[model samples]
Target: MMTNEINKTTGLIHNEGNFVGSAMLFPFNGKLFAITAGHNLYGKKFTDVPNLDNLTVSDHTKITHPIRCILGDSAFAKSHDIVLLELDCKTEISNFLPIRFCTIPRNPKHSLMFRGKYKNTEDPVTHRAITYTSTTTQSEHKFLCQIEKSLLMNHNYSSGSDWLGGWSGSALFIDNHKELICAGVMIEIPNKGNDGQLLFVNTLPLKDLGFESDIINAENLDFDKALNAASLAAIIDSFDEKTIREWEENNKNSEQLKFLNRKLNEIYPPDNIVKNKNKIIKQLLAGKAYLTTELSKNEQIFKQYNSAYKVYNLDSKEFYVNTKAEALTQLSGIKSSYEEYLIGNLGDDLPTADIKLLAIYGVSEWIADCSLDFLKYE
Candidate 1:
């Protein structure tokens, strides 16, 4: 069965602002805006949380839309996870580097596979067996649909997928019927294992948020907009698959390691010294020295993580990254943490040192050891 390829909930965010999560993007007043969790922004502006510098993931793909964030008026939009925003300074919206919704509307009352894009690619990639989740726990379930594709992108944040500290304001969206629509903002997630089911904010009105649990909309926004304006399909379908394939190939060769590179742009390492790679691999399987020192370098990778503490600031998600890097660089010395899916236990009343020790590790859903006495490092 071909699983419906759920388009990703994504938007290109630029400019400077605060009190928002990078996972949120919504259209407002004809100008596109980056929507986010209000708490992420309402903190001190430009520090420790989602700000312009931190929110912009790849400046090479900057969004030219106006940026603004005001306390959301749910009465007007009827969406609580939403906030009104305007872009900064002088910028006009362009479809060239257009935006996407992180969340997409769905008819649970109707039968359809949920799907979305995890990262941008030259050709639209499709995945089957889609899984969607939401963040709220009050008798209603909300979810950011996670597609189980093998792409090395945001496929597994709760399962060894390294979702960075500054990815909140970004929207999780789906590309539906050639037009892209948002489904939810990437709110915080529980990292223990369920991948922060509570952090997902589905655009669809979940029963917990007090909306129709079994309603489906037939009106297609993209089709109507195109007929009214006579514009091309939303950027997702507008792309030429061949051209994008070539572009993706060139990028992978330039960007990825030779062994892990995908088929689209896969190539061998240039050095002839790497010839007879299979023979060398066999020798290593038996016993070899090439890996002796090279593999040894990773022994104390956490030691270098001290840079985060040295450069601590109330502002800058970099600080958070540094702290996490510090704790994770030494996964060998670490034992499994049984915190039941809260990433780093941030919302807990655990002691400071225990919190520090746990914050630095990655959360893979593989069941952990249960019988061994627990170990907590300060």
Candidate 2:
């Protein structure tokens, strides 16, 4: 997305008339979240209020809403340098960027941009032609980017504090030729002069924050290309029994490994079974299966399901569902089970982190049969 488009979803965080920092609307699962730098809420500069109840967010429309809850806190921010917030009002997802988590390491070859409000400004300024330097050694979670020199000089800041003071919690996007994928959040400036590099906390950590299956993989953004890349016969013929045996031998004792292996076998069965299941897999991928009717009611859910199926097929080398009827049955059962689980565990007194986790992974049942371990980062 472009800077002007992103500005529609960007907001400013305020505490008692003081401009804390910049924030952007993040759509995950079925909820809208506001993400910003952690220091804005928990840094030494702001000590009076440690929680979100005292905070409010104002977007470009100038409409303000009280924060409903703090899903992630300062402790997480200290390590991750990002804080996740929940707003009390409703917002259209179309106005915001799609939630695609960058899973690979970024380098100078990539085009980048930063969009956020500068000190109490209503409109966000776009900083273009950013250069990716290197990942910071202090933490694997953080990376460094040099701001375009001309843009930096035009701002004319005397010191690092003057340059980066109001820009905390701003968003960093990687332009992938087709669309801009949100890759990081601005956290700090490590140097003292006008040449200081902008330090950012990448979005990969959000998977560990319990958004693994919900966000789309940045690598798999071109769904149409992926769908047309190979035929079903080629996919089935490419399967290597030797490789499967080696993987099983390496992790023979792990129950999780066994489960994953069983699922893999189902995707690449005997020749007779492959002919039958191949039709099912193709129908599922093309959205012609029985579950498509139910999933189509919610566009977001359908998109997520489509992405999950594509990811599993391309990356994991497996397809889990056998038949259209079986998938529909499994989905219905999973929904019922999840509702019962929520009813039995969730209440008025659950911890904030626990509640956040539940909300984040609430849709895991949609892909319950697929292995999600590939979503995690090392």
Candidate 3:
């Protein structure tokens, strides 16, 4: 439903702690801009914006280029978690992905496209590499919605790639008569059992956020060369082990062969899932304890901020509360409570051992909230 050319507009946005989220290039006011979830640009300390200066955009081939500029002084924080950044210079619309100008609930059957991370077992073909994927929405909420498929690498049910915590900010698009249009930006992974539902900031609201200028012009976009049937078959055949092995045997001195083998090993590295499970579960449980304590301390600090000023939602202006108590309730009630999050994510209903990975995700969400004062003020 999507083309490989989507790869050109997608890249990773690195957080303060080596944490990587996804991002995409957009054309606005006749200039190219980088867009992502507002949370990805926030620093761990939350006092000031983390430096993304000279940020480079990487492609599927692992090529990188610098972003021209970050539009405003800070990310446009709102209830939707969407942020629009200005590029340092103008670029051809062909260089970035195109956004769809459609009504909400575009269609129940629309295919969403994005470039996200995957593990060897989850997506053995492109582990550690940000690759293209097409998935559809299962349900939509008032502000955000869930992706029907999980993007984890080696889960219990399917051997397909699902998203990890690092996949935040990845752009979501739908195919409309072969035309790819941007829909939303990923913001969270829903912690409901083995279901790795992704939360995305719907981009249709960009118009209300001052991005309404010239968004629907198709002349600003470009399409990549389509792969013919024979070329597609040949490419798929190269993935065959027997073919690759024979090719290697024939080209004993081929550097390309050696490079290909090394890359394959990285994608499907030998590691026991059983051992990895035990280690991860133990770490998550211990981490939960530590974070619980930190959450209390963080709560007290937030109280100080709340008492000084009324808190505001960064993405959506309609949801500000009167008191810190009400605000905290709104924050925790975001989608679900911590207990629900733990129960839905921790139990054995899921197939993979990494389902507990959401525990750490819960911790980060709490930590980020503790610094809500740093986001935006009324």
Candidate 4:
């Protein structure tokens, strides 16, 4: 799960009709931003800012455009190359992995984990190692991170080339207790040398970027908002008005509605969901075609939904049975169906099934899990 989360955080940056390097989705100030090494966009020069129209980033699942770019302004920022691109707030960025900005100084004793995409691949990869030492230049603005060995050894590289060229903008993280604590961004391999040492601009300079007070500690990071956004995004992507309306009408007075309403309020405050409900519904309905095409590559997701639909119905009261005998029977039948699906015995039972069926069933399951009041009756 940690690996998957890391993969979602990093993405490929493309501009000028070519792949540049990699970038990570950074959440700050109740908004999302993309961060990468400054050199990726400015090249060797620090002052060169390119045309912003063509710059875009992709996680391979979706593409997002930057609304504005924020360059590093302080001496600390220029010494340690860094750039932040403010992403469009309305874009679906809910799938990004939650990360905490490290406010405290990095400790060399802790092992480091780096995640980024190679220039040739769409998916991101990871490298883990311990920092050998950290050096400070005379300018006192940057901290050079020297690792024990080459991170490129795990990859199949052609002989005679030892430079880590394609990983300029990768994110360096410290894995502490299953939480990803971002330490810095990989700026470059110093002088293109092959000494198995790399340079990272420590994250401490993020304080100079006007976000010092907002720097979240790994322990205090609240993931509830992100999780709520993810759930709402899924519903928007696979939206079916009839199914949702029916479910809402039936569960209006139930505890499920109360819990869901609370989550909705938390995500979009001041009753945004209520005020823009019709507009959002219309937009989601119109986007169905585009979303389907974009998600067609992951057919397994649809298959899982279809299998679950066959196992249970959203409107069925049998799923909320009061007796142990009835619960066991339902569980046994669901297990049997799942086993059959796993072995490919149930081939295309509902090939043309609406993906919304899965959404309804998923919501029902979520509500049932949250309110297990029927268990007391048994």
Instruction: Please write out the lDDT profile of model 2 over residues 1-378, one tens digit for every residue.
Output: 143466665778888767878887766566667878877888844333565666888876777767887656556777787877778655565555654456433445344677777673556787866767888787887888877544443244355545446788888875423344577888876654356578888876666666553444443432222221221222334345553344336543255344434433433445544343333233223323113322233345446545544443353422245554454454345445544544444433233333232322333322323433222122
lDDT of 4 by residue, 275-342 (tens): 43433333434334323432232355545645555564433433565454565455445545434543
lDDT at residue 215 of model 3 (Cα atoms): 42
Number of clashes found in candidate 4:
0
Looking at candidate 2, the ten consecutive residues that score lowest on lDDT are: 224-233
> Given candidate 1, what's the lDDT at residue 79?
38
RMSD of each: 23.7, 18.6, 26.0, 19.2
Lowest-sum lDDT 10-residue window in model 4 = 219-228
Best by TM-score: 2
Per-candidate TM equals 0.35, 0.53, 0.43, 0.50
| True lDDT of residue 137, candidate 3 | 52
Best lDDT goes to which candidate?
A: 2
All candidates' lDDT scores?
A: 0.32, 0.56, 0.44, 0.54
Count of steric clashes across candidates, in order: 58, 1, 20, 0
lDDT of 1 by residue, 303-326 (tens): 322233223212222111123234
Candidate 4 — which residues are off by over 4 angstroms? 1-4, 73-77, 103-106, 138-141, 146-150, 153-163, 191-193, 213-378
